[model samples]
Target: MTLAVPSSAVAVPSLRVLPLRPGALLLELVGLEETLSLYDAFQQSPVAGVLEIVPAARTLMIAYDPLSLDQAELLQAVAARLGKKRSVGVTETVDIPVHYDGEDIADVAELLGCSTSEVVRRHTEAEYTVAFTGFAPGFAYLSAPGAELAVPRRKSPRTVVPAGSVGLAGEFSGVYPKASPGGWQLIGRTPLAMFDLARDPATLLRPGLRVRFHDIARSSMHAVEKTAVVAKPRAGVPSDIGNGIEILSSGLPVLMQDLGRAHMAAQGVSLSGALDHGNFKLANRIVGNRPGTPALEIAPAGFSFKAIGRGVVAFTGAPAATSVTSANGDVASVDFNTPIALDDGDVVALQSPLSGTRSYLAMRGGFVVEPVLGSVATDTLAQIGAVALGAGTQLAVNSENVKKPVLPGEQPAFAMPKADEIVTLDIYLGPRTDWFTNEAVESFLSQSWRVTPQSSRVGIRLSGEPLERLDRNELPSEATLRGALQVPASGQPVLFLSDHPLTGGYPVIANVAAHHLDLAGQIPVGAHIRFNALNAFTHIDFVASDPQ
Candidate 1:
């Protein structure tokens, strides 16, 4: 299966699969450098269900959907062809203009021991190849910026870094694309929208694309908010059964979501959408939203909506102490345990919940949201959706509404998080679980790990013993996802959540199961935890996912 790289055509590794239980092992060619980068895989063998790929300086880390093909069947297919890796591609050049006027520009220049202009010179001089995309929507991690601009990350990360801000640290350089908390040294800012939800592709930069910075005039910077409304939704019933409630008094933090945005991982876009996929589905089933249909996923203080249409919406996740009022002024409290119907402008509002952190609002008919990248899932990470939920975001109603689920008010049967055991965690042996000492490993499985204050949609930093690694001191970046409990060389074990970076320099000791995924969603800060043996939970075979 070892074929020489053909200059005209990108090399493709023969499809070699590996078995690993509900998942498959994918052995494909990856480019490492300009002459041997693995960026060619995404361009040539563009197959469906490609989850995420993290291309570093010398290797490409891949994580695929396991439910489609079991791990056992996949390993056997890939074993023979796992020989000398061939080059996937060279690189494509793309010049980017920068302002070199970030708040940390001078500080970064001082660290590099040169004039601020020299910092910009060395940066803008040599071309930077995109390594990978993750952390946020369209956040491209460019390859090494040569040695002159090499430096460590800031000791204390800033609380907020503005969008389009250019940064450099160690071997990587990237544009912020969006405002967020980060530790990279800022060097400049860009005028272009690195990540745009309204854009056809969303993210323009991809791994292997060569990039350079060009300074632009400050006055040229302006907002790129082209609101393209796809009016008149396709003819179909919005959902099943009863009349749906209309949004009456929405208090910020309301969003329409589905499974999420995928395929754009290389562009650094996040798979943003519902916090709890299970509840999102359950609520939809109650009101009868088809898979991939748009449902409202709201926060603790949920918004109030009035029902002008006939349909029921179920609040499935974290018990939002919700109350709904009839048009006749009959106010009644509705619990998350059941589904309720609203008849024409009936107002519904979710007061703060005592136990749960988030809530789901599923209409019998899915929201009439415009689809982007084959989904209406709003990616807060990449910022894709009909629009960000705000005081003025409006949703259109469909004329030929769809049928609701089997039952509108009928409560669906399901599994929920245990009210007790604040310190218990389900586990599965990980790819690098053997790297740690038996004691360190034992400590990891037995000790109570506390949720640190530094927790968010991105990741939850835990306060626990340093799980010492006896083998190599560092690990090359690889595919990280939800419930990925990764241990960096620093000894702290971080539980990566929904918005965790696609690739990270850490060792994942275990991955939480899909059934238990909800438990990790709103793990209150300061809560304690300990790991349970992987065998403690039964393996519910996951079926292959179908595109909606």
Candidate 2:
């Protein structure tokens, strides 16, 4: 006889719903099993405007479009789904071959007060299921309930953990798909390719999949290893497109970006796109290209490009002084926000911006490149999308068919942000504020924090008096978003940026307000920032009629 799983009606009451961002909500559930059950139910009957449903250890992050669905209706739909009786589906079991020798093998065994042999036996004996995938593509979080291998993460995380290293921490086991910073205790190493973009599914593991580890002799580790599947060549990027720009010299960092990829977050892809959206859109509009067209996100200063064909070019953001020199030696100064005509072989040079950190350059037609997962945005952290621009890189532009733009008589002007200025950002506290002491919360709001040089597209490290946490427990991995003010063990806060990680273990005491996201992007290094809390009720868009 087939065994029947219990209904989730009793479990539904245990959920704590919290509003996250503009159109997202966080549903804190009891266990990984219930989280997976709700995930399955939502997939069966998805609500309108619900783009992606991401599951974590004990939370479900639901991303929706506010224009199509109201926040209250979305909550009602999800609550109804959880109220129904649903059966957990059959799970696929995968066996991973691992060599027993690792750097932390003896350390882990000593901490658990057991022999190294017993540690390996316990790990292999238990059946672990994949709880979720995050941090990086194909990085799955595995858990074995009612197991005896619970342990604490290292006091300090390694700067770089080698790929294929098997690790364990706090009832969880995972293999690093790529080399990255991690704190999990190393138990062994696996030669299996956990993540390969060339494969049909890309990721080797997914939520709800069963995993088992088998012991393999060190001698056979290389013999049994499988090579990554070869990827098919992508189309759309031609070697010698007629209307294209050849890079003579580029600034320190230049990347191709669009509006970013939002629907692919469940696959561990971040929404890495243009940092300053207001300037990116204005640049495209001035050049008569589509608003979501891929453009060059040039860093402040030292960007020069030669036009291969006659096209209209416009630059916005940072108010950089520009100069255009034609092949005939005729030179003209270009004004910001106004479209400039570029002849064949005309060279354009942009100096350092008087203010601001990033600028956008868009042509009459958008840049044509092979898109990965429906976006041209380059994510430096996740290493997705187009490669970074270099001095000799050739870029193809779709200037052959330019669309006529409808413009107002007066050009729209945007003010640039001044460097070394104190900027106040609106934030919403909670989701983890109870973990901090009252004094810590006050320090977070009143103190003026300086942006550290270590800040990047992933996150901004703030320097200030460390906020004290009342609780000393290790935070479980949970869904994180851009603008999350995550506080680590050292009490320092990290403000997440566009290419931030999908999930993190640090407690996020506050999130930057939705309206201030673009402004947050332009915050330069050495700038001072103060976060002010906004009323929580203002974030939700309540519908006039509630769903029955």
- The top-ranked prediction according to TM-score is 2
TM-score of 1: 0.75
Tens digit per residue, CA lDDT, model 1, 1-548: 22232222233333212111123121323333421233353444443444555555444445557666444443332232233243445666777887767778788878878888888778877777777676665777787545477777788989988787888766778887777888899887777888665566667687667787777777876653233332222233245433334454555567667887666566665566566777777777766557556777776565776675655667877676678778788889887746677676677777765554567777666677667776676555444554656443445444245565445454423433333436466766565676777788889888888887777666778888788887875454555667778887678898877766766767777777656666677666667777776642122121222224
- TM-score, cand. 2: 0.89
Superpose all Cα atoms of candidate 1 onto the true structure and report the RMSD in Å to 1 decimal: 7.6
Worst 10 residues of 1 by lDDT: 536-545
Give the residue spans of candidate 2 off by over 4 A: 1-13, 83-86, 223-240, 400-414, 536-548
Cα lDDT tens digits for candidate 2, 1-548: 11122344253435666656667777777677778778878877878799888888888888789999987788778656664444567778999999988788899999999998998998999899888888887789998986688888888899988888999988789998888899989999898888776665677888778999999888877632333332112232364556667667876868889999876755666688888887898888887777888888898769998987777788877777889999999888988787888888999999988777788888778887777777888887877778778676666677654676724232434355566788999988866776899899999999999988888888889999999999888777888888989999888899998889889988888888878877788787888899988844222221222233
lDDT of each: 0.62, 0.79
